[model samples]
Target: MEPGTHDLRVLIGRQRLCDVLFEGLGAFMLLMSLFILAALFINLAIEGLARLQPDFFLDFPSRRAGQAGILSAWVGSVLVMLVTAAAALPVGVAAGIWLEEYAPKNWLTDVVEINVTNLAGVPSIIYGLLALGLLVHQFRLGESILTAGLTLGMMILPVVIVSTREAIRAVPQTIREAAYGLGASRWRVTRDHVLPYSVAGILTGVIIGLSRAIGETAPIITIGALTFIAFLPPAPVSAVPPFINFEWLSSPFTVLPIQMFNWISRPDPAFQSNAAAAGLVLVILTLFMNAMAIWLRYRARKRIKW
Candidate 1:
């Protein structure tokens, strides 16, 4: 071979070798991440599995020497999770839709966008402090379930907003154009075409956001979510003669994280075991939400035509 061709062949071989090295490094990193995750799951299971029992889900916390279960905390966590979803979903989705579909390209929108990006990076504890001031002190909501839910709603709003916008943006522009071609108004196109297409994405984002909100303790604690509540929240709503009431809104609630914190802080070995059990429950709840989000996304992908 000519000398020039020989050098070119050598260069190509060196490039291929470099590519192989980089690919191997990437694979190694990916494997490392999986290993870490598996180890964590194993550790959590080892610590918590022994305490898992039906009674753990059926009894309420007791300060009276030996009779304790997490029933009230479980109920409180459910109420808080539901309330957080109720408050965050509509507002976050609306904000996202407006930003992605309607907001003018202006400095004001730019500023709002920047602030939202920053807010997502803000520490959870900062949101907790904000909740303490705004909900507990100013609003006098007094560590109630509503206060905790609202605080978490605010904490996760940026995440929901960002995810919803991405979902909305992913809808094909051709669909919107087709709607308009049919003489549909902008509102009609959004309501009928865009919104339906984006529903799965929106639901997935909402579920993931709620999962994070459900696991959070800082913001709720800041809003004074109780460490223990003896009572289950009143059924979501009531319809007695001449009155409609949401008693859950006014009730004090305890969540798994708060209960775990209380248990883990105690001197008793049994309480430590209880904390591990509560941790296990929290992990299961988060995993269930994640699975649902994955299922929704899979369905959405299956339904997409293009």
Candidate 2:
């Protein structure tokens, strides 16, 4: 064999060995991370699994640990998230669309973009303070469910906006060009081509933003979300008149995180168990939301021809 052929085979063998080593390292790191997460979750489950009964979700918080539940907290969380999604989704998606498609590229737009990117990284506590000053004090929003929803909405607005822009940017420019070449208007092109292709990405961002928002206690607490509430807000659906009531929006509320916080602060071991139980539920709820998003994204992607 030629000396050069021997050297080439040795180089190939060494490169292959390096590739195997790198692959092994990556697999080890991934498994280690998964193991840590699983261990923590398992610990939480062990601490709280006994508390996971029907009454635990249906009853109210009580001084007696055995009688306590998270009914009001979970209800408030659902309502707040509804408002948050309503308040953030349209506004965030619209702003992203306007910025990317309609708005002129200018210094004003540049400033807005830069601020938005920066705001995504801003501490949640700062948003809490801002809401306290602006929504609670200035607007007299009164630290009700509306105020908390708006606060959390604003907190995740940057995430939604950034994710939206990134998603829209991911769409191939060729799609837009083809539509334009077919004489479709800009709006039509965006609606018919860009948005359809980007819906999966947009939805992923929206759900991911919501997942982050669900666990946030600082901003909602700062905005005066109650730590303890025995009563729920007015029913969102009524039998009379318009059939939908908005009174809940103005009603004071508490969420799972604050409920857990309240419990954890108590000296009683039972309360600590309650807190652990609530935390476990919160983690599960978040995971479920993410799983739904992933499923929807998969289905959406599967429908596309490209």
Candidate 3:
């Protein structure tokens, strides 16, 4: 072969080698992830399988690991998530809509956008400290369910807003123009044309944000949420005519992660088992939320055409 032909062959060989190297690297990374997850599941199962009794879900925290349960922890988690969704979802989505659809393309808008992105990347512990100083101290919310909700809501707000903006941006400009041409105002266009196409993505983002919030231990801990609680919050339902109670918002709370942390820190092997059980429950809850979000996204994609 000529010199140039030999060089070309060498180049082809190097290209093939690079492709094989990258393929192997990708496979190795994937395998590593799977192996780690498998190890975690196996360890948790070994520790917690026998402890997954019905009473484990019904009872409250106790000194004895066998008597301790996740009742308050899980309930508090649910209540906090409810408050978080109620607080963050509307504001985040509205902010996103304003920024994407209505905000003037000016320096102020650009600065605000930059800040929001920065907030999303801020350390979770920093948010905790901020919540500790601002909400717990300044506002006097105390270490209650409301405080936890507010802290997590603020932490996840940027995630929701960014996701919502991206979803809205994904709705084609032509769609907005067509709506405007049909005599629709900006509000009407967003309400009818933009939102319908983007609700799935918005919900997906919201749920993912909530999942992150659910797993958060730092901020809530920073705000001084109790790690062990033997009692439940006041019931939302009442026998009287005004059948709802909001008093529980002020009650002390312990989230799943906090409770799990408490157990995991104990010297007893039984407490370690209990912690694994709690962790497993939390993982299941997070997975369930994600699955619902995925289903919503799938349905939205199938139903909404360009």
Each model's lDDT comes to 0.85, 0.89, 0.91
On lDDT, the leading prediction is 3
| Tens-digit lDDT string for candidate 3 (1-306) | 567988999999999999999999999999999999888878888888888899999999999889999999999999999999988999999999999998998998999899899999899999999989998999999998898898899999998999899899889999999999999999999999899889889999999999999999989989988556888999888999689989999999899999999998889998999999998888778889989988987887788777
Better of 2 and 3 by TM-score: 3
Candidate 1 structure quality by residue, lDDT tens digits, 162-205 = 88998899899989999999999988988898888898899999
- Candidate 2, residue 157: the lDDT equals 92
Model 2 segments more than 4 A misplaced:
1-28
Clashing residue pairs in candidate 2 are: none
What would you estimate as the lDDT of candidate 3?
0.91
The C-alpha stretches of model 1 lying farther than 4 A from their native spots are: 1-28, 64-66, 237-244
Task: Please provide the root mean square deviation of candidate 3 (C-alpha atoms, Å).
Answer: 2.1
Which wins on lDDT, candidate 2 or candidate 3? Answer: 3
Query: Positional deviation of 157 in candidate 2, in angstroms?
Result: 1.0
Badly placed stretches (over 4 Å) of model 3 are 1-22
TM-score per model over all chains:
0.88, 0.88, 0.93
Q: What does candidate 2's lDDT look like per residue over 162-262, in tens digits? A: 77887788788889999999999999998998887788878888998899889899998788775569999999998998999899999988899999999
